[model samples]
Target: MSEAVRPGAPRAVPYLRQPAFWIVIVLLVVGAVRIAQIAALFFGSFPLATLTAIVMFGLFAVPFWLLLAELDFLEREPAGLRVLAFAWGGLVATSVSIPGSTALDNLIAKLGSPDLAAEWGAALAGPTVEEIAKTLGVVAIVLIARTQVNSVLDGIVYGALVGLGFQIVENVVFAIGAVQQAGLGDRVQPVITTFLVRGFLAGIWSHTLFGALAGAGIGYLVVRRERSRRRRVAVAGLALFGAWASHSLWNSPILRDSFGDSVPAVLAILLLKGLPPLLLVLYLVRRAHDREAAYYVGILATVRDPGLITESELRALGSGSRRGAARRHAAASAGREAKLAVRRLQRAQAGLAVELSRGSDGAGACADRVRRHRATLAALGYPEAVEGARSWRHTASTVGTAALALAVLWVALSALGTA
Candidate 1:
């Protein structure tokens, strides 16, 4: 994506030349080496445990990935960048954070009383050390391809990936920790139980959420370039603090004492503890999406386009489910080709809107894509359902799948806890 400019604006930084690009390459290289070593140990100790972690994290991560895709429904970030964001989270952030956090915790233990160290060590160091590491992942990506991150939504998406990277690795580490107590029973039991709790129960509110909040701040700084630098810096600082506070609260042992030792009690306590920040972040995400959609929708409306993006397309583009319905409706009546064409058309139009909004040089290419898609759809007969709401089948399928997942997780956790 070439940088869009006014008649004589300064050239945008090419993706390759950006320092952030090299920084990501370096971090990924280092992190890959570190993670491979850990994976070897995990496999050596227990093969099933290693596989379980991978599978569970993948399953747990799908919802998040899907949500991020929805958030970027209009102008999707490059797949390469999104993957790198996840790698930064799972690989780069985790590889560096663990050691850095340990060292800081050790230092705190030496200077402070053992009780104080035990109680507050994580709360203090996690916000300072870990958040910085994860937030940097978001910052680095933004810096590398500054134009790629056009809004707060992009920031949250990248930030969540960084956090997810940390969360998955941390969950695996926790599962691996169960290895030390192998003599207690089946070694795999601890791994399974940990996955159930961390991956299924508390995964959403963990690192993924934290990184998102901080990333949004970074993104705000990028998009609102006209805003005073000091104000932007303050937003970034507050975002980091919000991420840190949530992390500290999650890590803090204070909740353990407040809740009973039962499974239900523990789950309730965890939800209560995690909900505030999660809700706050969710609200922010919704607002970001709305604001971004408005900007792009306005662009589509203003630009010299007649049939490129219709009002119906604009409305459908605003919601993920609607997009699915439109595509599905096309597929149902027309055929596979029609569905594909519809998707491509929407993508092109959305990309065009994004390019126009950002004043990027790639708008022409996007326009070409729209033209191709339009020809294909016209050939196949544009089959579309214009009604606003999603079908009953779609709604049921989504809700039922969620219900089943929660049920299975609860059953597995309860059984494992007893065993």
Candidate 2:
């Protein structure tokens, strides 16, 4: 997970020497203590409901963790850093936002009429406090590990993990509130209903997406050093504003009054509010990924050693689909072992590219790892690269997955009722 420093990239500071590191550690400890106290109260009040919410949201994080981990496959963020980002989100941001958002909402009520605050308080206050808290999680990462925050993709990865942490913890808190509001005597039904609404319906484009948008801004601010400092700060501000605006729109009451609360209406509202930011973040991610892929692939091309990385394999490594296709092709032509070997070879080649980018000799440890994997592939009689094809089986699987997802959505909607 070591990254190459670009010409004029900021020098790394030891974490122990950085005052910001100590500040972050203190905040995390305070947050953990606050969360533990809240958990104790929840357990005392509704043990079964609290446990159910915890378990459900804990499981909800698995796919998100896996998906975000792969976002920067070429140069994966260190596992420790990833955990740190998530912890900041779940602990520091969530704990701070609970009280901060409430206080801001109260302030809104004082400044404006009660009607204004009642209708617009959440839209105004929640995003202001929560987005700032969550965005700071990304800033904290940058302060702690400047070297790891080299690319915009790194920012997106860290931001999304922070958002995921916030989203999960916030959802758990909401689930518990649902139980209390329902007056159902510690029943799990309210928790399940909350999960269906928050986790199933609005999960994708919620906090994680917002965090990523803000993270992109921070990434741009830090990595685009060639730009004027004023311009970089402006871009970062715009990005944070974008994140806040998106979150505010989601919390606003504009659609609720106009569209009613039927299942279809709810779905439409979610899409209307969520789609723009989702599409924007997707475009940013695609652009960032392509740029990074080109840079890494260019580094590998200089070696000109088929034993290390053939031209075709080099091409495949730059693409997500082609990389998967290479492995699938290996499985079809050779055995499963060949498929695994191809994957290992691709990873090893990526490592070598990283090593080369850092001005290391081609004969270093990364190169040795590449040679070992290449030899393993040759032993399986599949040393050369393979191309991907669109097979009938692939098409069928794609269609089947879509069908299953739609079915689940329908069931969830029905279970929750139309209004």
Candidate 3:
């Protein structure tokens, strides 16, 4: 007997037609249900606990959402993946770490004494569990979508986002617990104060910073696999240890006696603890930007295409304000569509350059990337102007240099204020 074909099956099914899509759909449905439950818990009751929970949620959720929305760099990211990352951070990570920490705390209390437990609470509970929980979300992302994390900066960004999500949910619970312990009227001031102090000031240092530190390690491991496996593991361990140390220091009561309710003192703590990580992030980003630029220039240089984009144009694209000016110039000279096309071309070129530098079929890949970018520009009605043009010389250099100068000045002023 001849083998029978599967009934109603396509002879050629695309890989996209696999079970993974349905699994994603089911996960999305479940996530929606969980989010609804959280919303109900946060807002349904008329009790002070619910109100306090809402406040805490606002403190975290607002900033987190705003930051994500405002970040134009992540525009190419898939929405589902982003949501999944946040869910992983907020739900799975939080669930595991909270109960585990509580159990360990209870064990310690029972074994030693309540006083010993209290002593260990901030030292152990806040830093170790919370950092691990939040960072695990980033780890999940790295494991599942390893290719998406191109650089160390990407890891820091993703990890920080996950941490922010966890912090929001955790804060809500903390606020509600505070309200439950204290009466409604008495709870209001503390809740508000805590929201400001924790959500605004300490929030940057808490989960996001810790996650970024850990993520740097994860990113290093993924990017630099050419190195020894043992070395990679050591680097990742060091990153985690650093994150835990930073978290512990931030939660320590060492400053409570010395600083005691002064706004500057609080700001000082934030600067001292938070600024270093942020500066590190900035430095990484700058290096990434420079490397990307150099990679692109090298690729284009092979074809003797110096006019397409110059070093200055690359520098300008690295700056926020200079990029804006480039867009405005494009709009005025060509149109809105052309302006968008130019931006898309820049991004595609940068991405392709990075791929080429990674030794991934350099010539063919670069050609394909250039073709795609050219097609986009043509569709946007800038086919002629975008091709082999020397537009960067006059506009990009001046804008980039000015922006860099302004950034330096701003940093200096900020330092003076603190001093």
Comparing candidate 1 with candidate 3, which one achieves the higher TM-score?
1
Candidate 1 has a TM-score of 0.85
Each prediction's TM-score versus the true structure: 0.85, 0.94, 0.68
Query: What is the alpha-carbon lDDT of model 3 when measured against the actual structure?
Result: 0.60
Which one is best on lDDT?
2
Give the count of colliding residue pairs in each prediction: 5, 0, 0
User: What tens digits encode model 3's per-residue C-alpha lDDT throughout 1-419?
Assistant: 00110011121334245465455445546645665576576455425656666656665676665665333241223455566667766776666666778987787789888997887677677677777877767776665555556555556667767777777777766665565466564346545555655665567567766776787787677666667899988987888888888877776665666765454565566567677766765565556434433444455445445334445555555444556566666676678887877776666555554444445555465556666766766676655322233467657888999788546545544543453
Quantify all predictions' global Cα lDDT against the true fold. 0.77, 0.86, 0.60
How accurate locally is residue 158 in candidate 2, as Cα lDDT from 0 to 100? Answer: 91
Q: Per-residue lDDT for 340-403 in model 2, tens only?
A: 9988888888777766766646438888898898888888888876666767887798899988
Ranking by TM-score: 2, 1, 3
Record all residue pairs in model 3 with backbone atoms less than 3 Å apart, i.e. clashing: none
Local error of candidate 3 at residue 66 (angstroms): 6.2
Q: What TM-score would you give candidate 3 relative to the actual structure?
A: 0.68
Give a tens-digit lDDT track for model 1, residues 203-246.
87888999999998888877776779999899989999999999
Once fitted onto the true fold, the runs of candidate 3 whose alpha carbons sit more than 4 angstroms away are: 1-44, 47-77, 185-191, 300-311, 318-345, 351-419
Model 2 spans with C-alpha error above 4 angstroms: 1-13, 361-363
Find the candidate with the highest TM-score and give its number. 2
